[model samples]
Target: MVGAPVPALRGKPITHRIPSYKLYFEYCPHGDLHDVIKAQVDEREVPVPRVRSPGGHMRVQKVRRADGRLVPRTNRTSNVPFHEGFVWRMFEALAKCAVAMERANVLHGDLCPTNILLGEHDPDRFAIWPTPKLSDFGSSRVIDAMVASRFTPPETMQMNFVPPELGVMRGDWEVDGLKVSHRTNVWQIGLVITCMMRLEFYLPETDWRTGPSSIHPNDELHFHDPNQRELHPHSFQHANCNYSPNLLALVRQCMRYDPARRPSPRALLQRIQARIPGSCGGMDTYTGDRNGSIPWNKTEKLRGLKKDNEWPLGDDAEVVDVF
Candidate 1:
């Protein structure tokens, strides 16, 4: 709602409704990535293990494999140890998104946690609705380099979750017809999972105890030092809860680094359905309030698919400089 105009403002302020006519194709109160997830989780959630590369974890802007090779980081829970049957429902839902995407041929070039919306609401608080329309498209293609520069100054297309072939053209893609592919969306989807689940990929370090800034969008997409607030799903809580790992992974798969490496939307659909063992029913709903807020666990950080305290658990004082 930060950017949306007030309903009563048409009379007092400048006119608008004309440009926003496209809102129908873009928004759905109960159909989004989040609803697809809420349709899966319950009170009892299976705990999962966090997975990261050798150097703690890779940054979104820059990802490397566990073996030190620069590679795509897609397949959200595939790399995680706790990805088995216990509580990987969220990852499956994310996989479903990809499956659903294939039916539409609309690639989610740039995927992240925010693009993932929640659809289930306790009717006691609001209502249970099912709106599984993938919310953000063209978002990846519309990155404001000036705004992006403030975070990591994005250069060299990401390869963490995409196909290796795309990596071959990572450098200077502007001149090449080498556009971000479907797999690219899949890669970003995986990252979205890592961030939504309690386990996350990276943590931003700006001495929150001293900096004039608060959490930035890139914070959910970056990680540099061992000493930083983690991006756990619990960190993004608002009401009394946050996203479950099963739900978190749904977003992560969308955030995969490589485009080709991503699961086709159809494949993602199969994966998510297998996890939930249900149909894409209207058991969930998520309509952003006019006020920029929602009900969930309240935390000030956005992490990947990892635990919070375990990140800096080691006593090795080694400082790896990402910059």
Candidate 2:
């Protein structure tokens, strides 16, 4: 069996044992917000105690498996659309994550559907929503306006999700010092929400390429278009068709061309809380207040909640598991 082997420069191999799950749990105290289960890292007849690491010149970071299960993007099928309630919950997770990262002076440089992991409801803890955990911080960086300005964003970033200023650099562009601020994160969040809303109006594939219900040539469903490229004429036909007016307005504001116009991640969360009480851990006292208020349905409305692609088992859904 392959595992982390204790290494030593002399005598017996001294093992500085740390449970894989424990490390992640410590890294994120509010793990449940992302649907992460509080797992017992070490459970044996005789429990293992923590051991301090001896002074070593070199250090390494090793990855390990945990006991909880997660929902991969590949597993999601397109047959059934995500409900308004479930979509709101997903928005809550991503928005909260963005706000938390901003406060910690970190930027999740890469934000897309694949980097988001969904966890099943835990009956034991009364977690109802299939909570979304923002994962894969490989492209993350400590918040620095200067460093962020010089950043030539990764080409591999999902083009549809890339913010306009970052994606297209014009010679006459004015330097606003807010290039990669909380607003950038907001744009990404808006993209994900747009994609979910588009998915609700997804048309089934058929043999005919040109028809009323056939999938259009440019009906790219994976991610939302931030560039607003030449969209199909029928695209806006579904505009605010299934999504609430407020939800639609929020997404539009987030994807605004000017970064300064976008709301802060914290502001975004507060707006959602005002609209949908308890959607993101707020008191439900104002649920009855209706002056054009749309409530988030607490019912399970997700269908075809199965992976559609077969990617890796862990970490960015990139590498395949060999074991």
Q: Which candidate tops lDDT?
A: 2
Evaluate model 1: give its TM-score. 0.35
Candidate 1 achieves a global lDDT of 0.37
lDDT of candidate 1 over 1-323, digit per residue (tens): 21111111112232465533212232223333432333233232222333666799934433577888874334322212222221233444455555545555544554443455433332322122222223555433332333222232224322332222232222332122234444544655554554334333322322232233456644532222222213354443223333445545555454334334355666666666554533222222223345534322212111121222333423753545321
Off by over 4 Å in 1: 1-93, 120-133, 140-179, 199-262, 275-323
| Per-residue accuracy of model 2 over 1-323 as CA lDDT, tens digit each | 00101111123333447422212211111232211111111121221222345774433333233755442212212223344555666676678887888888876766766666655442322144344667677777776765467465433244445554445333322233336676778877876676565543112321121235455535533122433332233432234336566676777777666777788999998887666643423322223234322232222333223332333244656543221
Error of 1 at 98 (Å): 2.3
TM-scores for every predicted model? 0.35, 0.52
